[model samples]
Target chain A: MSEALVDALNPALFWEYRQVLLRGLAFNAYVFFSAATVALIVGLAAALLRVNRAWPFRWIGTLHVEVFRNAPDYIMVIWVHFVLPLLLGKLIGQRVEFSPFASAVIALGFVYSGYFAETFRAGIQSIPQGHLDAGRACGMAESTILWRIILPQVVRRMLPEAVNQFVSLFKATTIVSLIAVPDLMYQVSMVTQQEMRPLPLYTGAAVTYFAVIYVVAGSVRGLSERWRNKIYA
Target chain B: MDAIPAIRVVDLRKNFGALEVLRGVSFDVHRGSVVSMIGASGSGKSTLLRCINRLETPSAGEVFIDGEPMGGPVTANGERKERPLSDINRMRRDLGMVFQQFNLWPHMTVIGNVIEAPLRVRRMKRKAAIALAEECLARVHLSEKGTEYPARLSGGQMQRVAIARALAMQPKAMLFDEPTSSLDPELTDEVLTVMRELAADGTTMIVVTHEMAFARDASDRVLFLHNGQIEEEGPPDQVFGAPKSERCRQFLSKKLQ
Candidate 1:
């Protein structure tokens, strides 16, 4: 096993594998942005629903949260890849433009949005009633209170959890390789097919992922520190 | 006495469901005197102050602010009539209020909390509002702490910042509902000091306070509320020093508990 691994670790292999990794980053970035947008919408919508005491809206929010949160991200990816376009489109009776990249994000975002929504709901409600009263007492229109006072604090409070969700989405984007979007893991598989050495190829992909997430961790840590200082100053 | 009453409430009645809190309450505050409302818990002192600012609408009757109607109207038969949002906001801007909880925006810095109103409602330039905010902060002895956030400050400092935030709006009248009640005894002095200073400046403050000492010292007149109505109203010396109503005596005595 050691010899097999060492034999695969050629310098030529390193340089050749580098471009695949770069392509992986380019592909994954789209998924990351798409998922981020989707999760933000879902999370904020869920948070608003958490405040809704009305049965119908709250139950709808609840059903979204429960079904999405409990289900695995990979399974959703498979369903989006296979079933949704045909079945859901037929039900609606119109043509829908759904890309593999777009569908991958929808699935991951739907899964993680449930998690982020719970986080955001907790953050929003965790604010003391005094804050809302202050805004109302100041004669602000209701929108001003939410935008300036409530949502900023909600965003500040939710940032770390949101960053974590992004990381989760990034890793989960790799699952899209099975659906033929040519993401990071797909690049790894393609390289392995040519080199015929799974060891070096697996090691290369792991490093690329490790590098991506390592940078993410650093960026989020920096952001958390900066935000904490401003808010806690 | 020719000066118009800054606030006039006549037959004001408010209820949260079956519980009638302000039962036919009537009072008038002259243009530039400090009036303090004192009562035991649940006696509707805070509720009355809130009604003055229209934070809570009256179930019946009228509150007139600087000769303008607030809390809107109720029919002779007592149905609530609504006011347009724009008019209500206009009225609210003319009357600034402080709360027991201080309610400073935690997301904003001390200066941001102070300048928000002038920028939004008054539409003042950012630079001018910032200067005005500093001036207000200076009045509350928070000049050097403009960059500070509420969560970092002591309770006393936070409430003073709240007062500055209210004052920066340049309202005709100010209401404070148990403003220092949330502070510790040490912190209460800091808040009351600002109140004393505002009173000296003739700021026309309507303060609801449990601080009997401040009531006696700061107010031109003190109204003792019992069961949502003024049980007694007179100059502080007469009301607190020489009680007329049986309820007033019981309330002051109960404070000894």
Candidate 2:
């Protein structure tokens, strides 16, 4: 039992494949950034649609939020990787194949955008009508009021909620390994297969993810809190 | 006085569903004249002030600013046509409105709130906008608070900042919608002093207020609204000293007590 525990705790094997494992972590970051960008842009659009005066736009936004928010992340990734390409190919009258990276990004991005849309919508609605009235009374156009007055306040109010969504998005990037994107978990499994030592490799992968998520999330939360305090002060 | 009044309201009526808030109310505010609108809660004084700026669209009737019609022209059937949004925005620029809630944008500094309109809507140069903002802030005695956010200021200070914000547009007339209703007595005095100074400077103002002292002392004329119509209107002295309407007298006795 002591020998087995020593083997499981050993860092030597995990360190030996540092280059490949580091590269895999970098891929996770790439996927996270790409998906986060998509989610933010699309989410804002959806939120605006949800709050629109017209009924059709509100219905479309509601549909988008319900469909994506309720869908499982793993199933979405698989569906985007496998089924979406076939559908696209048939519609376009040509063959279409998505790279694993593209599928992972698109699937995760769309799924997370639903949450972000709700967050943004809540933030937008929380603003007092008087603020909009003040803007309009000053002769500001509707678009100008949205950009200058509405969005700034919404962004600030939504920051903490958005950060939680972002952290969840970062963790969700690990599921990309199922589609062969070679993220950290994927590399760890490959290394475990080669070395035939499941204990240390899987343990190391879990610890690495824990440390990275903890530090990144902590720093981001701290920085945002400081910034918010300064503005509100 | 100029041939064109600063503001003209013709039979303005507003209805929310089945309930009528304002019923065929009409009045005129000449340039450089101070008109005070006084009423009990839900008497539609605020609604009348909001209609003049098209904030709450008048269900019927017309608002004219400096001889130019607001919103759209009326068709033969008495329905008001909708004007282009840009035209309405341009017309709104001539009127500066201050609200009971202050409604200063919380994220921006005092000066940022003041200069946002001139910089964006008027497309003024950055330096020119800042200069205008500073001058307006000075007029409200908040020149030192330019860099401070609204959350840090007292209610009185925040309302003053709101006043400076409106003043930066250099409007032809200013509208006050219960500007002191939200303030404490001490805070109310500070705001009223600034408003009194504006009145003394000959700023065209339509103030909807419950401060009878301000209505009596600061106004060239006073109007009392009751049940969506002007119940009484005359010189401040006559309106306050010997109001013709029994409703106006009752309202005054209750408020002034």
Candidate 3:
């Protein structure tokens, strides 16, 4: 059985399929990075809007969090991929479509932004009221206070939670492959069907994900440690 | 007639819900004079100081700076009209306030705290703001600690940094609300010494303090607050030396003990 297993897991096969698998992994990387970046910005905007003095903005921000957070990621992604473009085309009288990658990114970005928004809001609230009073007493405008004092402290304090959110977003990238974006999971499925081999192919995919996660965890730890001293000081 | 006072509160009143913290409080601090407000805890001394700059809105009455109404208009019905944000900000620039807790921006270095308002509010050049910050820190005797963060400093050092941050704005009058109340007995003297020098240099100051010595020595006038009203006010020589009000005498006797 060992001999057969070794023979089945041939180096030649892996060498031949390396380019396709690597391309799929690269595509996964792109989707996760883009979605995570957009999620961060949208989350920040939503958090600020929720806390803003204006009634409309606060309402809109609350709606964003409520709608997206309660919905499932796969269902949202499927709608973005299939239904959104058709709706837009019918409404606008133009054939509107987003590429599979774009649809996946947008769907996942919105879904995760809701969670990030709550995390950021908690961070902002953790700051003492005295800090805001001090800023105002120094004659700083509200916008200046938010930009110079509040946001910097929030970002620093929220770094650990942000890392967790990014990791979750990275894992969620696998769901994009269901819409045929040819990410790592999609490649694994294709290779397993073509080769009639499940064990070695799935093992390879698992190892790839583990490696990426390990690197991410290490990098986040290093970055967080370096900031710990400077931020609270 | 007399020169206009730097700060005057006319029949100021404040309420937190049904609880009235200040009921019809009034006082005046002449330009370049130091007036000490001494009272037991919860006597509305801090609330009165805060209302002077509209940090806390008054439920009634008015605050005047240099004899001009400081905040927004009062309607005929007596509701306080909201002032334009820019106008409120402009008013805050001329009135510096130091808190009991020091309230230093812990994320910023000492010089950063001192220079922030000058750079952002006054829009001074960075180099010049730094120069002015250094001067303010020197005035508070914290010139060497400019690069240190607030958490790295002792409570005394942090309070002095707070004073330097206020002084850097070059405000017309400085308000000290229990500035030394959170410090050690020895540390209190350090802050009071800097304040004494500011008083000597003829800066208009309103200090809410528990330091009887500071009230007696550094202040030109002393106002004793009891139950949200001025129980006694006179030259410190009279108020502290020969107290007339029974409330004033009792409060002083307890404090001195």
| Fraction of the true interface contacts (Cα pairs closer than 8 Å across chains) found in each model | 0.48, 0.80, 0.62
Across B29-134, the per-residue lDDT of candidate 3 in tens digits comes to: 8889999999899999999998888778788888888777766777899877778878888888989989998888877889999999999999999999999999
Tens-digit lDDT track for model 3 on A1-233?
A: 69997877655665668888899889989999899888888998999888888999999999999998888999999999999999999999999989999999999999999999988888888888878888888778989888888888888788888888888888889889889999988998999899887777777777788899889877987878686676464
lDDT of 2 by residue, B112-227 (tens): 99999999999999899999999998988888998998989999999999999999999999999999999999899889998999999999999999899999999999999999
The clash count for each model shown is 0, 0, 0
Q: Candidate 2: fnat, from 0 to 1?
A: 0.80
Per-prediction TM-score = 0.92, 0.97, 0.93
Interface RMSD score of each model:
1.7, 1.1, 1.4
Error of 3 at A130 (Å): 0.6
DockQ per candidate: 0.51, 0.79, 0.65
* Residue-level lDDT tens digits of model 1 in B132-203: 999999999989999988889999999999999989889888899899888998899989999999999988
- Candidates' lDDT values, in order? 0.85, 0.93, 0.88
Per-candidate RMSD vs. true structure? 2.6, 1.5, 2.5
For candidate 3, what is the TM-score? 0.93
Regions of model 2 farther than 4 Å from truth: A231-233, B74-80
The TM-scores, chain A only, for the candidates as listed are 0.92, 0.97, 0.91
Error at A128, model 2, angstroms? 0.8
